[model samples]
Target chain A: MEYIKEPMEIEERSFKIITEELGDKVFEEREGKIIKRIIHTTADFEFADITVIHSDAVEAALEALNGGCRIYTDTKMALSGINKKKLTQLNCQVYCLVDDEEVAKEAKDRGITRSIVAMEKALTDKETKIFVIANAPTALFTLCQQMKVGEVKPYLVVGVPVGFVGASESKEVLLKQNVPYITVKGRKGGSTVGAAIINALMYMIE
Target chain B: MEYIKEPMEIEERSFKIITEELGDKVFEEREGKIIKRIIHTTADFEFADITVIHSDAVEAALEALNGGCRIYTDTKMALSGINKKKLTQLNCQVYCLVDDEEVAKEAKDRGITRSIVAMEKALTDKETKIFVIANAPTALFTLCQQMKVGEVKPYLVVGVPVGFVGASESKEVLLKQNVPYITVKGRKGGSTVGAAIINALMYMIE
Candidate 1:
């Protein structure tokens, strides 16, 4: 139980603990990576059954990361949870646009959630590939709508908005879409889960 | 839906939304204040039933705040979510000891969670009155163990650790203890929820 001096060691220990606790329950291949990371981040075994990764999501995410695409999150908590050092080494920038004044103003004007506006703004940047919508269903819904209208094309979407309101419905929409996505099936997600997925991808790519 | 220019206006609007969405479900009196804030913070009304506040917790927390007690959180996200501007006006200092090197080393040596070590360290400071544990059940369990040993006496313990593993059980143990506490009954708590309770207390004190 002594504190490990290296951050990598701590992370490895966490993964080992997760494997010991929930190894039999985890999915195979790249999807297992996302699920293990989620469990490692929250110590919640329920995520094993709840998490859904599109068949092609892991490869798509890795491709995007290797190509130096930007990662966008909806909450600062998610931003903080990501390993900036590893991402810096890979030349990937993580952005959380929820606090942007322009997004706030646009959301207010459009009578929509600020998360949705942030997604719209993120789409404006052509390099924004990975969308980590962890706190807002509106963001996921907006992303779905924009994709439907062919307004933007993202490499991968991690939609895990946790709540009773639009959470389930928004995720259901993602399930129906052809877009590459990784989501928890129900209302059981948060910024931490969102960041874990991205971090897992970063580790895989590295 | 227009952007509220003033911060107070935005807060007011947020409260209004909470009232409209879940006012009928909220508890009476001071308890309702905490519930509404939790809902406002997470956009989840389920917390109304899940959150349990000791009858003496609000008064105890207010007394400590008025006395300029140091607020200790287990995570930086909880620290960031607290209303620091208001706490600063009240001369209350906030501390998150999870990242402290001493606590980290202790956690590693003891083979316990960093949060447990952080709580142990916080107890060393007699001024640590309020324990805002939003992300770690081991911390709450450790606090309860210390209290049983008559080692540390805290004014209030906000135990809102999220996860399936040991989260509900740890909170159940807290419910049986004599310590004045505010906790979510199950695996549905987080840093935001913990911060919401503290923010509610701050607003009520203000």
Candidate 2:
């Protein structure tokens, strides 16, 4: 019935357990940090096998964070889960347009998911270098369409939308493209996962 | 690459697929609604097997919602994911005290997690009949401790805190108690899950 009493102690103990559970499997340090954090956040070890981080993904995200680039997430929940202390220290900004007046109106007019409109609106902001789709596959599909047409090429795409419909399929499409990205391979991701990925990258920014 | 365009269509299609994939299993209408909604939210079918709903859990929650009872969640992300329209329709309020100035000062002074302090502070509000712990095991533990001492008796406790440290352990403690609760077995739950359960119950509220 006894438990770790201190917050820092709890977190530290969690990381240690993650390491022990992971065993001696080697990981490129930067990528390992992200996957480990995701594991820490979800307590789901499957992420170690399914998480896909492009060779250049960590470096690209780090560059974007250091440049003080903006971030756009599909869900406000994702926006809330991202670490604010690090964001404040980096002087970077994160935005979620799902609640935006224009985005809501546009989606209603078009009879489409607000995710589609939100993605389009986020793309218009030139400083937005990171596109995080944690809850809506439609948003990932939109980002992919933008990338394919050469209308937008974000520095990093954290695509971890969770759903049975287009969630896994959209990430499969993202993997084949030349875009620098990080994602989970199946229907096992969410707002927390997306935020964890971005926060891990922010911590890596030096 | 073509997918469902309209938001309603996408959701409808997703629900249809979930039903198809769920196969020949039968669940009580009320329990099925919450479980299906969880599956819909996470795209993870494992919930159908892992989700635990006490017999009185749903009814207790429904009665509390009808009474315009308050909700206290451990994380802001969970607070964001809960459906506002339904909550407003029910005339209920949801609060997350992790960011409260008094909570921060108290936790810092006590050298414990804000979750523990937040749960303690929330217990002070007699209207807070539903406790949702999505991202904090310490919060669930604190609630269980209070329940053990007969200091508080919430109508329902949504304990889905996801982490490696004490997430699953705290829920185990909750399971041992006589409190009405809905939780996921093992280590598979999160803020999204917590919000999904609440929103599902809200939708089901008459």
Candidate 3:
């Protein structure tokens, strides 16, 4: 898809659904400069990987895709940008936090499917990862639970969640599932980031 | 566990907290107000739920907990709030906005997680209740995916993430998840609104 060159900047982070003659793609502009662009392509390929100039750009791109997509974020800035609302809204089940059950619940309520387990809630190996994503301290009991349950496989978890409150926890949930899946390298990856990663993976598999 | 009382105005959404002082129970502001100062007793609940006087009070309360707490806003507000470095810096997440992978990623990078679901992804039965929160029309697909997945559980995966782009997708994700959740009661909800609801649930649960 081709993008028009008229870049606009807004102090608040927001999106503009600019349509291009070639196709529909998302772009990020800062101070009249097009810092990033997420091109929307046919999902003919399985996996795809794209670079992000700014974290917000990732979310913009992800917002334009279909469902059943997973996502990942590698940076705290990107993760927090998405927020709990975004995560919950995006149907995320995992979240990584830095606090207690209250924090975890808050993250979960915000659409973070999974959350980091706190020091107080850690129980087994599985819990360790959950806690990590939740951004909470790891515990022993959780580790034990995973050891007993064995690894969950063929995990059909979606990560393209917009909320980053529990991005860490979401990732950990996938990890605890003990399945091979796609995820963004940083913590702020959005629906498109997940889509791109999955798209890239699908390409590799195909 | 004890609180001291300074003369404060009692409102609809007010409560009180009790603290032990010199072997005697003391009453402090837990949430509401009593007609007069009374020695706190075990029969009195330690914490009380205050009646909310102003609609904006909800947003104010959310802002007060913005630092690292999970929050949910409507989609419009969620999108507008993206790229807020200071707010993003907090270890919290927003569950509003529908899933727009691009926006989701960008918001994450900016420390904002606007809720959304991409249009290029797939959906399955197991992936019920979770959706890409976003604007109208496109969010329909997200909801369809949840219905196909047999999302029977009420509120389990529901969110009304408000704000701009991915508000629909965020809410769709929650519906697909089929897990118990909370959101604003009326049409006023957006993608981020779900996040706010989730935040409230977290607070209540905590």
Candidate 4:
């Protein structure tokens, strides 16, 4: 398989292998696109079981993409993982406000994380369609808290923060929120997972 | 645990938890730092078992880093994951040439990956001390092939490409090469792992 394939065939071949290995895994087809992608990105089968996608997430995300909405991420690493060319084609923009001067000042003044402030800042942009949380669980938790107050109506939330701290627990909160969200159940996610989810959704829309 | 801890304490607490959970895992303290960082980034224990580190790789990498060397990566995502502030304090520079116009043109003409061309281009950088490969097996294979002919001698190579194709097979070749290297033994690696390894090494030295 390695010798005969061209360089471009690698990604295609990886998806094929993921599908074969994920045989008997029962995610709905709509959800499978994302599950397969997260699995493809990490080469970990754990996603197949742990991933949870809201019934409306896929359709909502695609619709939001078609509308050329704003996307926000917790980290620049996650921001970079998103394909820029494809995003531009869709007229979508990605922002990471954790490094913003105002956010830093406000977060520090309030004795809160920049992640928490960043999530709050995202709500100020009414064009935001998606929130991709990767490195900071506080970002995910803040979004959930805001959602509980009916403050922001995100088209989709990709909450895949990675760490031993509040990562998994934050994801559990995201799962229970009444919003379109995609998350993994346990302590198994990161910038890679968060970006893969966004890229996967983009591929689906494309 | 989450409620009482301050934002600054999150990272420290996460590392402590990783150490506790990783109890009984046998790795020399030096090697353990890299392994644990990979695990921390992905929240997966697979790396602890699959990581391979050359005996002198860490020392050589640190020495190179202290001299303010150049680092190259296969993908920009991996490049972004590297901590810029830490890297700057050491006077280390990171480059990802996959998007270089000359590389793109040559790769298209030769029907090879930009990754292959990118690795070859790194040799032109006389100060290049380390190569971090996360997205492309071709980059790893190219480096190993270059090493065989004594064309370029890298201080350290972090090979953690992902996928189902030649990703693992390329690492197998890298393992056989007489180079100072660190790699995961299978398909379970990505940009997150590569960057985490570099960041962990930076933290270790810091």
Candidate 5:
């Protein structure tokens, strides 16, 4: 008899390889899921070492996804990485302000980053529960400042912007924020990581 | 008088910030373009330190783009980051194998990475001039291996897979390859970087 594997089976096998490789590192329920997804996305095991997930981050993100809360990302790459078809079933929509003309104009007018302006616009919607910042540290910094001033409160913040400038600094602010969050310490995060966390939560919700 | 900045102006301003931040480094004619685009894409300056570009990489990539060569990437993010509209004008198309069911099947059947199988499939087309491996070191390794065996001879290889595993090793292989290449040494790259290089070349082609 000949054996055949489907695409889904291949993906499962890939996950198995990841789990076997991860062995004994991430045993926590939520942390394990997020880490697994990150590894799956990047095929990089270093994430297991760098990723810092708030104990309640997965739960908080799951709740938001279940409640059909609006999802926002700082980069279109994150926006594109998310499984929109799956989210649509739950009546959730993903938004990215980085490419918005209005956000760009506002950023220019206020002498701020477009991501900051997009975050400001997202705050207009009280239902915005999840924030994924994957590219710009300035956006993450602005979010922390806004949260500090009680301008907005989100259920979960995925702060994973990659860079040398303010990536670590902004993530430090997120770590200090009184909110459920998932971040990679230092300067090693990208839209792929951000989307992986969200996708992991989405997969776990069902 | 009040001044209004258009979207293009804002983009220019963003580039200016990147250039100012990148100061004193990367002033070369070609290297500057690639580095600027990487900074523009990720808002990261450290890329200037990590990225290693062959002196003729940009020239080779530009030639391929002008000749309407096909672009191949390991991830969808890289595929999405590329300026498809611009590539279309040059009669070039981008290919990503990770999402293809056939490629997945081949990967499973051969017990090889899907990206590797994708690269193999891509090699079937002699016109595939540019290769971008953004998220998988295994793909880069496999490409280098195939290139060694005379299976494929891509005009330019943009090898920027980020990870603790095989990332640097595969990039080292790329560096040793007798081919025009752009790679970031060690573990500091992703789909964004891969796409930025291609987009930079596309912009330069025009």
Candidate 6:
């Protein structure tokens, strides 16, 4: 009693391997752009990047924002992340949520960034595509689920949860999502690279 | 009797205008990457760009070459296009058809650049995804039909042919073909820009 589906399964697996290998092979010849590898832990971290790729992604993100994707993030973090307050200065509407309770309130009071008491509420009803790069897989998992069901669509997910174990687990979590995505393909992602990917994605997705 | 599609036609006609205006409104804010533009008309075309955008297109061409897309051009313009001897130095593979008479011999020669016969052969291969750019719609039309029936796949036609008057028409030919493609919208497209769009698409697709 041989199973007829085995051949189909084998063929499908072969196709996937071909596609993956074919795609990876092209990257070898790809020049001009740079990809930096990073390794870090929960103990200490510092740095930033704001480059985007696939230029269209940046255009799409800006369109989404104009169409009602509200900005939601910590003011200091966002500013520190990009090294500028001009992002907040951009007239487009945004909902900021500073991680610091006091700064969050002040931002909300001053209308500098949209402030929210809960992470869930802050990330909800936004028009911009969400980009998450967490240091913990659990954090990324929670954030991904929130964005998956939230108003914002994800253009790309950077599964670079830093620290010793989180990076690998983060990749696993993203792979489980079963969507068309691009990643660094290893456990070399950290806060800087994750932010760099977002910056690049934002640039590309805009 | 009312035509059901008239409203859609009118709306689409208006949509282009609205979209153009809106794009202008945000264009300053976006400040997208601008590849150098070139308007070539056989003669008086001086210099070529070797930017990252151009790199992408060349890489794609290289891949096609690796997978059997033959290189071709008018034999009369061969020695002037690029240092042919230098190209040969790169040492992958080469084919040529010197002028109209020796074209057959040149194709048989396999290492020279001057080619009139290979141009005819390349133009006639319908299976070839002839990625072209310029203002000549007629050239593309003739090339399309000449390239054997059922050989030229529909979507393989990337109508980035861009230039003065005929560019829009060339694009329309591709549009009529109803193929998946990528092209710069509005007035930003020229010969270089057209080529750049192909490069950008190759980056995204491959």
User: DockQ of candidates 1 onward, in order?
Assistant: 0.17, 0.74, 0.02, 0.62, 0.17, 0.01
Cα-based RMSD of the predictions, in order? 5.3, 1.4, 18.8, 1.9, 6.0, 23.7
Instruction: Name the lDDT of candidate 5.
Output: 0.80
Instruction: Give the alpha carbon lDDT tens digit for every residue of A1-206 in model 2.
Output: 58876989988888888989999766898899999999988887889999999998987888889988889999999999998989989988999999888989999999999999998888888778998999898999988988998888889999999987789999998998888999999888999899999988887866
Residues A1-206, candidate 3: write the lDDT tens digits: 11111112221222332132213333333311221222221111111232322333323334322232333222232234333444455444333232345745754564332222332233322322211121111221233234337642222223332322233344444444443333322233343333333332222221
Which lDDT tens digits does candidate 4 get at residues B99-180? 8999989988988888888888887776788999998888888888878988888899999999888889998988998889
Q: Which ten residues in a row have the lowest lDDT in candidate 2 chain A?
A: A1-10
Q: Candidate 5, B15: how far from true, in Å? A: 5.7
Report the first chain's TM-score for all candidates.
0.91, 0.96, 0.27, 0.93, 0.93, 0.47
Q: Residue A162's C-alpha lDDT in candidate 6?
A: 35
Q: Residue-wise lDDT of candidate 1 within A1-206, one digit each (tens)?
A: 12233334545666776788884674776788889878766666778988988888888999988887789988887787777778888888999888788877887887667777787788788878989998777778878888888887788999998765667778898888888899998767887788889988898974
Off by over 4 Å in 3: A1-206, B1-140, B145-154, B161-193
lDDT of 5 by residue, B71-124 (tens): 888888888778767988999999887878998787878776777778777777
Worst 10 residues of 5 chain B by lDDT: B1-10
Residue-level error in angstroms, candidate 3, position A54: 20
Q: Per-residue lDDT of B39-130 in model 6, one digit per residue for the tens?
A: 11110111122112222333455455345443332212111222233344433222323334565466446533222234455556444543
Candidate 4: regions farther than 4 A off: A1-5, A109-111, B1-5
Give Cα distance to truth, residue A192, candidate 3, Å.
16
TM-score of chain A of 6: 0.47
- Superior by TM-score: candidate 2 or candidate 4: 2
Residue pairs with backbone atoms closer than 3 Å in model 2 (clashes): none
2 or 3, which is superior by lDDT? 2
User: Which one is best on DockQ?
Assistant: 2
- Candidate 2 stretches with Cα past 4 Å from truth are none
Better of 5 and 6 by lDDT: 5
The total of clashing pairs for model 5 equals 0
lDDT of each: 0.80, 0.90, 0.30, 0.87, 0.80, 0.35
Q: What is residue A148's positional error in candidate 3, in angstroms?
A: 55
